[model samples]
Target chain A: MKLSELPFNTQAKIISVDKKIISRVAAMGVIPGTEVKIIRASPLGDPLELEIKNYNLSLRKQECKLIEVEKI
Target chain B: MSKNLALIGNPNVGKTAVFNELTGQTGHVANWPGVTVEKKTGKMDKEFDVIDLPGVYSLSPSAIDEMIARNFIVKDKPDLIVDILDATNLERNLYLAFLLKELEVPIIYVLNLMDVAKKRNIEVDVDKLAELLGAPVIPTVAIKGEGIDAVKTKIRKIFSDGKLAQKSSIPVKYSKEIEDKIQRTEELLKKDAPHFLSDKRRWAAIKLLEEDKEVIKEISASPNGIVVIENVKRFASGSEEFDLAGERYNIISEIIGQTYKRDKDMITTSDILDKIFLHKYFGIPIFFMIMWSMFEFTFRVSAPLGTLIELGLGALGDLITIAWPEDAWYTSLVLDGIIGGFGAVIGFVPLIFTMFLVLSFLEDSGYLSRAAFNMDRLMYKLGLHGRSFVSLILGFGCNIPAVMSCRAIESEEDRLTTILVNQNISCGARLPVYVLLGGFILGDGATGTIIFSLYFLGIVIAILMALFFKKVIFKGETAPFILELGDYRMPTVKYTGIHMWERGREFIKKAGLIIFTVVVLMWVLQSIGVDPDTGLLAWGTDPENSLLAGIGHLFQPLFAPLRWSWIAAVGIVFGFLAKEVVVAAFGLILAGEEEPEGLGKLVVGNLAVAGVAAAAMPALVYGYLVFVLLYTPCVAHLGAVYKETGSKKWTLVSATYGIAIGYILALIINLIGGVYF
Candidate 1:
């Protein structure tokens, strides 16, 4: 499943990220093989907040859809 | 040699608070990131001048701020760097610090918000973390001035000990494949491009493998640099960029596992608040409630004080009238030029002060990030960020500070778009034009609806222009919305107060000076003309002979389609001093007409004398309001635009674009109204 479709609070690991956005998101420690979870979605429900590397990062669904993920 | 110390951090990490403590300079600090859009410098004693650069998550130049921080770190090469970190968010905060390690500069790590970390039950072994990063760490609550002396003492110690910062080992070594690629570039640089070589060659090698454009541009200055780059491009895989950043995180996880401790399951106040503030259904309503309350607090509370300043200035003018009892040129200069020009700015003091005070509090409390996070989805559709929403709402209060607040927007394209469209938001000063004119021609019953329509029109135009600019001018991919919804802490009064005063004081100094000069210059222009009888230059107040009236006649034909006279043309031109002055200009410049008992009637009564049909006057007033709503901002607004943008191109775009659009829109309004009553 894409990271955008992951259920809230369900643990997952990033399988592979699109090369277009890997550097920026990966810079914050969201890389392949890292455990991640969707903590919350923002008010309008487009930007999802993910808990990874002991911090919360907000990314819009447009970017999140590019990341391929699998349930852990 | 005079040395410099630089402060770098992620946004909302108390970096500017640390800056203020070290330099004794008061720049604004808030929970929002990128508050220090441009670097600020101050004397840290006679020897060291401290520089504060805007926060960036990484050294890659994806945006203007990233470019700014990267250039300072690479080109200026400050002697020492102070990396401020949020202790609770250790792994992510250290990401930039890890990147800085590649610079090979001596660093003193400042771990701020330690109290918040402790409350979250996170334990940081300071000594171990410092050793892992190869730096001295001092934990601080920078807003409270805690651990500040330790940071200063360590800076002194590092500067005194000259023989340090040697390359001990590789910084977070990548896999063997990428390592070989780095070695190839490093060896090439040390041999053929010695002219461009430094201790940062290893960093440049890593950047070359990552295809970092700024570093590539630097190395390309030497001819051999192309050969080196082409050589690397042959054997190197494109995934080295991901591998390198991945390796750094791998190393960081190892460091955190050993030295950092935390309770991951503990729910905190920020989370609870976010549940309501970022609620699926209620979030936007709550956000707007807070915004409306902020608006109410700014104007409703400051209205009396604003009136007090205006009345006080009036009484002083009355006193001068009583004391001299003479109709002299000096009296007019003092009353209209000096007092009138400067007094209008002083009236803004209470309103601007309270507006920033509330905004600073919102930003410092961590609610601003939530506001942006919630608003970003809507704003992103409009080609702006969630953060631009705050600046736009603040524009309703005044556009000067609204433009200044755009600093927190990281992308240059988004920020410029926000500033360009901000003036259409219809500020408080513009309200006087709407209310005073709406009542006289249309009566008191229609005034409220007219004011509402003009404001609604301003917002619609602002949204349309934003979309227009995005599709045509900016054309960059919609900006990414990556934000850290940081923990909310109780904001300290001392910090918020200082932030308010510091930002408000900027309006007084920069915008204030511009308003004063234009007001006085307008006075001089209205006073001088070719003497009607002598046919020579002379100082007089005759409306038919003055230069201002002549300029008014010049532009009168442009508005002739709207049925406005030359006198109205003169008022619009004088409105440039500030929007609030347009009403007073009508009262001052309408000579030889029966001065009606009230201002609204005076403005309305004179339009008929200028060839506007009595039936068409009301419709023309609507066109006039539309023109005022869209036209160029006041001089004070332009002064602020120039000061913040520091680019003559953007400021000139702001000045000219609005007048063109305003003219076209107003003409459309008049033509359509010509069909009806």
Candidate 2:
């Protein structure tokens, strides 16, 4: 499932990140094989703030759609 | 004898943890040089003084943090420079190591984060790498204190040798044509500039080849500048190396291919994320929502704390009045000037703290760089270099740091432009203005809308200013920014909390210094008079009657054109001293009213007056806000301008230009509104 489609605060393991999101992911140090734990999602479940590798990052729903992930 | 050493690397390479392992004492962390980047210095287990410079990618200073690191290395010239290379990202880390080596300083390489590398199934042979570079390379897990003692013992032995080991030439690989150009430029440079980092000079030439503005300016300003520019330009233009960024990337790619082995898959992570976030249709809204929430949190989460701070100041003022019942001057000084003025400033502490906390989270978690990347196109549209986006973001914290952050832009023109536009960023200090005015002029719920509008105003004004400055002041080609978007990391809560509190404590400390002095000065000005018996002091209740009031009156005609009442006019005048003081003065004037409840009541009532279905109120308020927004930034910000620009002329230009633009805009708003209303 797309990461953005998940309910708020849902934990997910990123399965595949699309090629186009490289710059954004690179900026955030998010590489394809990293586990992402969602901490909070904006009311709409679009800009999700996630906990990863000892840090928290917020990404928009549309942005999250690029990442292929599965709920844990 | 153990010699002094400093570990310098870009932030996040475990410099602090390494310092802790080496020193055994929790290192004392402060800002590097004058910049806000954190600096850690301590004794190496009671053997040597080890300074941990803020994490910086390269020695060519750009940001406050980078400048601090660069200046310390250049000015302090530590005995040995330990360049900590992140094992996972050796190529980029080595870019800085290459620069350090060029400084003619002996740099020992420590490949940190080996555990993380191992987890990733990446392997690096430390001995082979050391042999290749002619520097001892030690692999260690900085977090676990692994191999740190060995690294320190090697440093001691190297110091005992009394002569540093020479590293073989690690000439960064560029294209063959570019390499030829560098060799030519090196020959020309060798004749005159012996003291410079010859390799750094080569890099600077290439940056200039890429038409880097800041480097160009530095060269142009020097006596040898014209010659260097002509020589480099000849080589740059001849080879069509204007695509310097692409060329540099290619070189890095080639070098990585040869020396480093990575799971070729790592690059794909960032690309995938960038696609959606950098997508034209969706990226902007996502960015806007993030900003909206940031402001929302800044206001909402802080409301309770704001009340607490306000009440604390109120109680303190009440205590002073009760304690000094006999001393009216001192009582007024404490209550009206000190408490009142200071309270107006301190009231925004909650928002400041929360904002910093969020900002630190964004920065440490690596979202800020993404935001910067997403904003790059817009920044270009606004006629600003993308690097300025980072500084502008920093401006949300404080104009001083923001102004200082401008150094990150490699172009002098961009740096100056960023500094000028920085004031329009509306720092936390000025948040009180938005909170006060938005609350006072708009209404309770509308306060958010008002603050949002004011922020929008700042952005619009910044865009306009950029356009104007580009056309008039610093006219040249708009330098295209090529930014490296770092990967995302889960932000460390402990680090983010520390960063947030550190900034909050700074705001409190600034109140203790800058606001304290100004508050006392306000009291002194209020107290002085010619005669007590006549009750007609130097300046009457009318602003024209007193010293500051008299000066304010001199500018009344200028503001009169804006439709401000004399008291309102005077408030804007005192705003130059500090924007927050505008509220304090406004509070004092309304307190002069019959049954006035001071600032709080004045804000609530006046905002209602403005919100009522009256065209005149909106017009007048809009005009008033324009003046407030464009006028000279506070004295502290001006001091910051002076420090950042390092010129009295530019500071004057910034102050005068802001006031001039503000006056004209305010005049237009009021005049048009007057006719329509």
Candidate 3:
């Protein structure tokens, strides 16, 4: 499933990232095998904040959709 | 021998605080990323030269800050890399450390925010971590000045003993397959090793395999480089970069597993705060309320202080006028040109400082990021994401830094749009003009409302222009909003005070140089002209025949639709130099006719003389304020825009757009107001 489709607080392991921003997303420590939890979505819900490796990162739902993930 | 120590870290890891603590240099440390966009250098204990680099998550350069940090580390080749890590988030930060380790620089690992980490029951075994990383690991609460001496001692030891490099651990190992490919690539690179100047061939080979653009460009320029690149590319199946990153994380996890421990159930204070601060319903309103209170605080607190400054300048002007002979050219020049023109701009120092004080507080407290996050929805409509708003908010303080801060925006189109629209935000320099005109036209009771409305109008217009430009001029995809919301911390009075003073100092410097020169030139133009009747040179005699009047007449027609007179036209022209000069030009123009009690009175009297009727005064002033609000930013901001855009064509486009928008908006406001009021 796409990372953005995960419900709030759901923990998932990243499977793959889209080619366009794979390096950028990975550089922020969101590589494959990393367990990420949906922290909070913006009030409008277009952007979602996630917790990975004890740090919070907010990314647009569009960008989030590019990351493939599986529920852990 | 003194060594250059480069401080590197992930954003918001307190790298700058560590730099400040080590070097005793105030480098605008904030809770946000990209505050230190440029590298700052200072001497540490007269032994090491400390360079504070912009924080980056990894050496792979995707953003401007990351590019700067990567370029500096590779090109500058500092002797020692002081890698500052946030102890609370070692797993994420250690990835960068691993990357830096590949650069082969002697590393001093400084784990900052130990206090915060401990609060959440995150304990790091400093000695074990040091042994694993093969570097001196010092735990510090940078804000509280803990472990600073230990860091200094380590630096001193490195300089004296030169033992750090030998003691450093081997770089993180990749998986077997990746390791085989890297060894092969490194061996291939060894044949052309002379081109690799930094002796970081392993790093270069890995980057080449990872297809790092800068490294590829470097290698591709050399002989037989394409063959090597092709070979490296063939070794990895399509996912080598991800595999490499995953391998690094695996190593980091091992190190973290051995040396780090934390309470699983301890919720951070930031998480608690975010519940209310980032509340879906209340976030934006709370942001605006805070902003409103900030402006209210600025205007209310500065009013009395502004009055005091005005009184002092008035006394100084009187003293200058009395000390010189009556009717003398020097007397007029000193009192009218120097005191009148310069004092008008300087009178708002109190307001500027107050506004900056509050802004610095917001910036340092990390609330500014949350505010940007709240505005993401609105900003998204304008082809900009949330981070663009940070630059716009900085625009309120000054457009120069705001334009410079556009470097932080990842998208080229969004950044340029931000730079172009930033000038409309009613900068602090433009505040005095608003307060002066708004107070004159709408009375004290409505001054705040008028000011707020003008600011709101500026934002609205900026949004419209951004949408138009995005669709028509520079069409592209908006970069996704990816920002780290930093933890909210109590702002220190000392830091805010220093920030306020730094910005206020820039304003004063402009007054001393740009304002002073422009005022003198204005005085010269007003004082010298051919006598229209006799055709004789009339120096400071016939005011109607002055050069300024001639220039004003030429420009007055353009602004005539808004009902602005020739003098106001001249003021607007001078305003291009700096916005405050509009008020100053008016003061200088009416200097001899009357010593108006205040700037508001002088502006009011001038409007009446300009043939603006009493009923239309408010409307005309609002229209004129709109023009000033949208017009081309001051010369300093234009220079910044040019520098930021790196294209004169875009600069001209921005300037022309601003003037056209200003004229059209002013005309619209005037025509609508004429029909109603």
When candidate 1 is compared with the true two-chain complex, its DockQ is 0.79
Model 1 spans > 4 angstroms off? B26-37, B163-180, B383-420, B427-453, B471-476, B529-536, B577-622, B634-657, B664-677
**Mind giving the per-residue lDDT tens digits that candidate 2 earns over B473-560?**
8877654343444555555565567667666777777777766676566545555543445765653333224455455456667655
Q: Candidate 2: which stretches are off by over 4 Å?
A: A1-72, B1-4, B10-77, B98-104, B140-261, B266-276, B319-328, B501-506, B530-557, B587-600, B603-615, B646-649, B672-677
**What does candidate 1's lDDT look like per residue over B47-145, in tens digits?**
887888877888886766767787787888888888999998988887898888877776778999998899989999999987888778899989989
Report the C-alpha lDDT of model 3 over B176-196, residue by residue, as the tens digit: 888888889898887754477
Q: Tell me the deviation in Å of residue B92 in model 1.
A: 0.2
The candidate with the higher DockQ, 2 or 3, is: 3
Question: lDDT tens digits, residues A8-70, model 3?
Answer: 898899998888887887778778888989888777655778888877888888888898999
Stretches of candidate 3 off by over 4 Å are: B26-37, B164-169, B192-194, B531-534, B595-597, B608-611, B675-677
C-alpha positional error of residue B295 in candidate 1 after TM-score superposition, expressed in Å: 2.0
Model 2 / residue B220 / CA error / Å: 16
Error of 1 at A63 (Å): 1.3
Instruction: For each candidate in the order shown, give its overall lDDT on alpha carbons.
Output: 0.78, 0.66, 0.82
Worst 10 contiguous positions by lDDT, candidate 2 chain B? B604-613
